[model samples]
Target: MRITNRMLSNNAIRNINRNLENMARAQEQMSSGKRVNRPSDDPIVVARILAFKTSIAANDQYQKNMEDAKGWVDASESALGMATSTLQRARELAVYGANGTMPKESMQALGKEVDQLIDEMKQIANTSYGGRYLFGGSRTTEAPFVDNTGNDKNVKPVIYNGNEANLEWEIAPQVKITVNENGQQIFVDAIDTNTGNKIGIFDLLKKLSNALNSGDYSGVEDTLSQFDQAIDHILDIRASLGAMSNRLEMSLSRLGDTQISLTQTMSKLEDVDLAKATIEYKNYENVYLASLATSAKALQPSLIDYLS
Candidate 1:
C-alpha cells in the first residue's frame, strides 16, 4: 500500500508520544524515591513489598504489647518488694514482743506498730498500675483486700475480694504470657501444714497483734516461723515477675530484629536509588528530545503550513 503524508505524520506523532510517556515515568520515580509506585511498575515486587509492610506493622503491635506488659511486671515487683520490707519490720517487732520480761504497756505499743504494718500490707496488696489493681487478677478495677478487723483484732480482718484468674498478654503471634498474679493466692489461703490451718499473711498479723495486746508470750513467739514463710512467699512472687520481665525483654529484642530485617527487604523491593533514578530520567529525557526533533524533520510540510 502507498504511504500517505497523513499516515507518516500520525506514525511520527505516536513514536514521540511513547518516548514522552517513558520520560514522565522516570521523572515520577525520581520524585517519589520509589521504584514500585504502582503495581503495574513490577507486580511481583509490589506484592512482596506489601507483605513486608504488613509483617512490620504486626511486629510493631507485638513490641507495644511487650512494653505494656513490662510496665505491669515492674510495678508488681516494686509493690511486692515493699510488702517484703513491711513484713520484715513486723517480724522484728514480733521478736521483740515475744520477750516474757516485757511489760504489757510495751507489748501494747509494739502491737500498735504491728497494726500499722497490717494497714501498710493491705495497701501493698491493693497496689495499682495505670489506675488498675495489679494484684487483683482480672478484677483490676477494684481493691483486692478489704479490712474487717475494726474493733476486734482477734477476727480475721482482711478479706480477699479479687478472683483467681490470670491476666494474659500476647507478646508474639500465638505466644501469650500471664501478666498478673492472683490476689487470693498471694494474700489469702496460705496453708499451715502443722495445724492444718489456712493462715494467710493477714491472719498471721492479726493473731500477732492480739497476742501482743494481751501479753500472750507464746502466741507472739509462734508467729516467727509463719512470718518467715510469708516473706519467702513474697520473694517467690517477685522471682516469677523478674523471670517474666526478662522474657518480655527478649521478645522485644526479637521483634526489633524482625522489624529491621523487614524494613531492609522492603527498601530493596520498593525504594529507588537516587543516583540510578536520576541517570535513567536523564536518558529518557534525551531520547524524548531526540524523538521530537526526528518527528519534526520527517513529517512532510502540509498545505496549511505553506499557506501560513
Candidate 2:
C-alpha cells in the first residue's frame, strides 16, 4: 500500500493498454464483420463454424453430382425417344410394303428405306453425350453397336460391343442413381417368346428388310407385333429415366435449401453484431480517455517526480 507516483503511473499505463486492447478488438469486429476472427476468440463457436463449413463442402459435391446425373439421364431419354421414332418408321414401311398391290420394284424401294432406318437405329444405339456413349454401359468411351455383316450380304448383322453394367452417380449420402443403361437393356433384350428370338430393334429391322426384298408380304406383317414390343420396351425405359430426372431435380432443390440454412447458421455463429460492437468500442474509448485524464492529474508536477 506504499502509494507512490511511480507505482500510480505504471498502474495507469497498464490499465490504459488493457483498455486499448479491448477497443482494438471492437474495431476489428467492425472492420471484418466477424465476431470470431481467430480461433481463440470463441473456441466453441469456431468449432461449430468449421463443422458447418465441412457439411456445406460435402453437400456442394453432391449437388454437382446431381447435376451430372441429370445431364446423363436427359441425354439417354432423348436418345431412346429417337430410337423409338426410328422403329415406328420401320413399322410403317413394313405395313406399306405388305400391301399385295406393291410390286417387286416397290418392295425393293421399301427395302432400301428400311436399310436407312436400320442405319439410323445403329447411329442411335451408338449415340454419344458429352464425349461418352449414353447406351454403352460402363464402356462409355467406345461405340456399343457395330456392323458385323460382310459387304456381300444384303442384310447386315449388328454386334454389341458393350456390357450390361450400369453407370451410376451418388447424388446424396448412400443414395445412388443409374445414369446409363447398357445397349443390351435398351435394344437387344426384347425377345420374341414365340420364335425364341430377340425382337429388339436391330434384329427385327434386319428381318423386316430381308422380308421386304424377298417379296414376303406376310413376313412384313409378322414383324409388326415385334415392332410394337420393341417400342413398348423403349417407352418403359424412358419412363424410368424421366422419374430419375424428377428425383434429381428434387435433390437439387433440397441442396439449395440446405445450403441456405447452413449459410445462415454460419453467419449467426461468426458474424459480429455491428451495433453492439460499435457501442462497446465507443464505451472503451471513453474509459481509456478518462483513465488518461485521471493519470495526468495524479502524476502532474509531484515533488517526488523531480527528485526521482
Candidate 3:
C-alpha cells in the first residue's frame, strides 16, 4: 500500500467526522431527554413507543367516558330520590283527603297543595345534568314530562316527551354500559288495574287532586295504593342507577392503572439517562481531539502552506 500525507489526512478527517456525529447524537439525547430522537435511531423502540402512546390515548378516552357515565348516573339517582320523597308526600295528602268528615274547603286546599307537588314532581322527572336531561333516555335535550292539561279535562295532565332508548357508554375496550333510564318506563307505564287505565305517578297525582277538590273521598282513598306502587318503582330505578355508578367507578380505576403502566413502559423505551448521555458526549469529544492532534503531527506540511 502506497502511504501518503493525503491518505493520512483524509482518513483523519473521516474519523473526526464520525466522532462528531456520535457526539452530536449524545448531545441531542441530553438536550431533548429522549433516546430515540428519530426513527433511524432505534426503529424497534420507536415502534413500541408509538404503540404504547396509542394505547394510553385510548385509555384516557375510556376514562373520560366513565366519568361522563358517572355524572349521568349520579344525577339520575338524585332525581329518583326526590321523586320517591314527593310520592311519599302525595300519599300522606291522600290519607288526609280520604277522611269524609273533612270540610270541602279543607279538601280543596289540600288539592291545591297536591297540584303544587305535581309540578315539583315534574321538575324532578325533567331533571338535567350538564344541560342534558338525565331521564329522557337518548332524547337528552327535551324535558321528559310536560303539563299538557289546560282547560281540556279529558286529556292526561302530564305527557311524556322522552323515548325508551337506552343510552350507553363505552367505559372500556369492547365494554359498554347503559347510563340512562327511560323516562316513559319510570313515569308513564304504571297501570291502575281497577280502572284499566294507565295511572302512573303523574296521572295518579292528578286523579287524587281532582278527587279532593270535588269532595270525592273514595277517589282519594283509591290513590293511596297507587302512590305506594309509584314510590316502589322509583326506588327500583334508583337501585339500578347505583349499580351503574359502581361499575363506572371500577372502570375508571382500571383505566388509571393501565395509564400508569403504559407511561412507565414508554419512559423505559424512549427516555434517556442524562448522566449516561453526558459521559458518552465527553468521550466522543476527547477521541475527536486526540485524532486531530495525531493527524497534525503525522501529515507533512504542504509547500503552499510554507509560502503562505
Q: Candidate 2: where are CA atoms >4 Å away?
A: 149-156
lDDT of 1 at 116: 95
lDDT of 3 by residue, 107-187 (tens): 999999999998898899899999999878888898878878567442368888889998988877788988888878888
- What value of lDDT does candidate 1 attain over all alpha carbons? 0.89
Candidates ranked, most accurate by TM-score first = 1, 3, 2
Which candidate tops lDDT?
A: 1
Candidate 1 local Cα displacement, residue 107, angstroms? 1.2
Worst 10 residues of 2 by lDDT: 148-157
Clashing pairs in 2: none
As for TM-score, the candidate ahead, 1 or 3, is: 1
Q: CA shift at 120, candidate 3, in angstroms?
A: 0.9
Off by over 4 Å in 1: 149-153, 191-193, 302-308
Task: Go through the candidates in order and give the clash count of each.
Answer: 0, 0, 0
Candidate No. with top TM-score: 1
Q: Give the better candidate number (2 or 3) by lDDT.
A: 2
Query: Candidate 1 — which pairs collide?
Result: none
